[model samples]
Target: MLEIEQFLHWQRAIGRSQNTVRSYARHLSQFYRWLAARGIVWDELDFRQLCDFVAVLTAGLPPLPSRCGGRAPGTVKAVSAAVREFYEFHRVEGRGPQDLVLTRNPSKLPRRAHSFLAHLEHRRPREVSRLARPDRQSAETVQVIDFETDFAKLLAAASTTRDRLLLSAQYDLGLRVGQALGLRHGDLNPMRRQVMIRRRDDNANGALSKQKTQFIVEAPRRFFDLYAAYLLGEIAHVDSDYVFVNLSRPPVGGPMTYSNAYQLIERIGAAAGIDDLNPHMLRHTHATALAKAGWTAAEIAARLGQSHSASADVYIHLASDDLAEKLRTTEHLVWREPQQYRLKGDGDGAR
Candidate 1:
């Protein structure tokens, strides 16, 4: 019999998230139960058996709605990771046969070009997706001005300045919701007019850094003043508390929920006559705007916490001056001027 409890203990000790640990536990339990039904023990498992297990999971089953809804990519990946980790853990412990192996690939389903966007449209509780179909031969084009105008309206119409600030931070500063919510009173240096986003302390619960690296975001004078005044209110609590919180008399901390933050954006969009504006779209706008403003792709990627690799090229392409710079930087030989250091008017070099 496999000692599942011992493995779970080790996982918790390793500082995995509560949700992650719970998910791993659930997946391993299901796997163990399935193996039990077949009268097979973990020690006796092999790669072939593991492959069969994945095949069974991939087999077309009756479509039933789950809490996560029908078969999500994230859920599938998590389950697969749990199973692989379990076997790998046993192998490392020297208790199970080394023959046991699980494929790391989660989506055995056939690749579909727009499946993810479709899933987002259909499965997501609140959001709607609309992907445009363009001619393959014609160059793909996006109306950046439209995106900016719509997003700016959304930010302006926010019910509270805090909500406006949140949107502004996402669009202007390129911060994730977690990072935004994680901001603290002390993080803002009004004297210097710069916000330091080092380690986030969201609430009494506390939050850990998602990227592990601390960065600073420069705010405009008006934004800094709004933040300063917001801090001065009786609603503001301790110096370590989150900057944005419920506007209660006592000032309940721990930051707002992710859903509330999203709903705030959506609500603002509705008010601003913009149908859809998401947090991620704001992030995209931030990156695209920076690129358009002649900022290097590397700089955008660093600020956006993105990988400095191939996709960086997209930012480069998005840059406004790329074409102009390329043309200007090309060098051409005006004249040969050879033949023993010839004078300004040589036969070969004369205009």
Candidate 2:
């Protein structure tokens, strides 16, 4: 317990966020409990015992009768990773034996590295997960919400106009939830038909754009129409600079928090009968739409504010149907923005 506390403290000192620290602490705690029950020494844990622990996690059987649910595959992987880190930390501090051995795979060399830090990252031996099984997923198997069916249902199920805008904000422009929540009144440019994504650190609701620089998002005409309707119906008298604010809640004019946004998405998904949907799915759907429309990797990266074009390959490489092509045939958008403005085309792409 004390070792975990020290590790968490060091993690915080090294500038890890509170959420990340909590996750590491929880993961390490669960691992320690497992070790204690088996009368296993923390540092003396061998590979075979580690594998058995992972097997127990994979079984999703509750270790204690009071516990109700089983751990997901992702959770199993996370817990094992924490255990490995815990032992490594203790060993490095001269408190335990060098039990967690990391061997070079040589196969995972820089030959296949493509992204900015990919080569530098693979310069050393990668952490081969001996505990959890490999999560084998193909590049062509990307799951995204269908705009015409699932996404449309999600929009119609939303109770308020603001909620519809929130869904559209993510799907239409691939705006991150934080960026959508961080939106201010000044960010919306009705004349230019753009939304400025500014990176701010001082939002009262703690919402922030993930990017370091401000970028303009070209929004559809329907997006702006919804915004106008929302402003008139909900926050007509409310005095807040934030575009999306609490209309029915106690904080009458305050900006919507991340918790509020997440719950809204969950509720909308359930109402639309969408299985296990999350907010990021909308962003993925948007990127997949672009990729299906034959947008280049550089173009998708710029649109999504990703660090590199190689990162967009996953969306482009998917073996999807002609959904984007079909959607584009019906959709219409004008090229309009203040600084990022371009000459008008035939009005086919998302503005």
Candidate 3:
């Protein structure tokens, strides 16, 4: 068996992230078990034997292994890396030869491709009508209105009207969970009908305007009205700063945590008969709504603070109704016959 201390030492020396090192250690330990099951010592196993072990690890079993089943080539590569690192450490320390760690090119292995198209079809099929299964998330139409209504319900159920405004801000502005929770009082501009999102790190305020970039989300008039009510109502000791507050009437704490936002969504979704409601779903609904309203993927990406619109492609599937309408419009433009007129030379000269 490989020495655990040496493996961890090598991982730390290589400057790997804590999460990554933990994952690598787990995969290598699993590899050790598979080797032992076949009565082979890891150090004594040849390169060909290692390949066989990998094949066995990936092959379909009756019940399938936990977390390891259906692992992609990338996962296989990760395991191989951990094994190689362990052997290499031994070799460099003079306990084994350098050749013991077989170095094979990972790119040569068969790659596993995840088809987003198939995922979309299975999750929300375009052929299915919305009315047939209104509860089912369908690609036939973007579910923006459903999201809006559910968000409204969440606000009403909130412990305070401020919480309600915060929920409204997320759906209305398409703010990410982090951005929504990090909002400050200065962020909201009622007259401008916009909010500014300042980025933070480590659940604490980092450098002001250092890692900070501002994003503007269109605040509906209702948001302004709600904010006014929240400020004027029972919330005593109201702080001039911080748009969102904790349960306390006077804002003793800063903005809400991201976890609180997630729990709020879960609670609200359960109340709205949408058990799977999530922040990203609201973002998806926003993207789908924009796409249907003739916004390009790039525009949607910019508004959502994404470096690329590739992630926004999932919402494109939700624009099936818009696509169908566009096709109907195209039919009239291209296939319809035009009225014919006889020229002067066809029958008689112009009078």
Residue pairs whose backbone atoms clash in candidate 3:
185-242, 185-243
lDDT of 2: 0.76
- Model 3 over residues 114-203: C-alpha lDDT tens digits? 576866755432332111222333333234535456666666656667666766666667776656666676778888987776765443
Q: What is the lDDT of residue 346 in candidate 1?
A: 68
Clashes of each: 1, 1, 2
* Candidate 2 C-alpha lDDT tens digits along 236-339: 89899998899788788899987788888989998999865777778888888887777889999989887799977665534424756655665555433447
Best by the TM-score measure: 2
Worst 10 residues of 2 by lDDT: 132-141
lDDT-sorted candidate list, best first: 2, 3, 1
What TM-score would every model get versus the actual structure? 0.54, 0.71, 0.55
Which structure among the candidates has the greatest lDDT? 2
Worst 10 residues of 3 by lDDT: 125-134
How close to the true structure is residue 205 of candidate 1, measured as C-alpha lDDT? 34
Off by over 4 Å in 3: 1-145, 149-152, 155-159, 201-212, 234-236, 248-252, 307-311, 314-319, 334-351
In the range 1-351, model 1's lDDT, one tens digit per residue, is 337877787787886644356668878876776687667777888767765555444442322124333443434445666887776677788867776544323244334477656855754232111111122222432223244677667757876667767876777777766677777777878888777766443244333445557877777676776675566653455444677676642435546655567777777877887655556557667777777676777787777666564555443335456566645655334344455876666677645
Better of 2 and 3 by lDDT: 2
Per-candidate RMSD, Å: 11.9, 11.9, 11.4
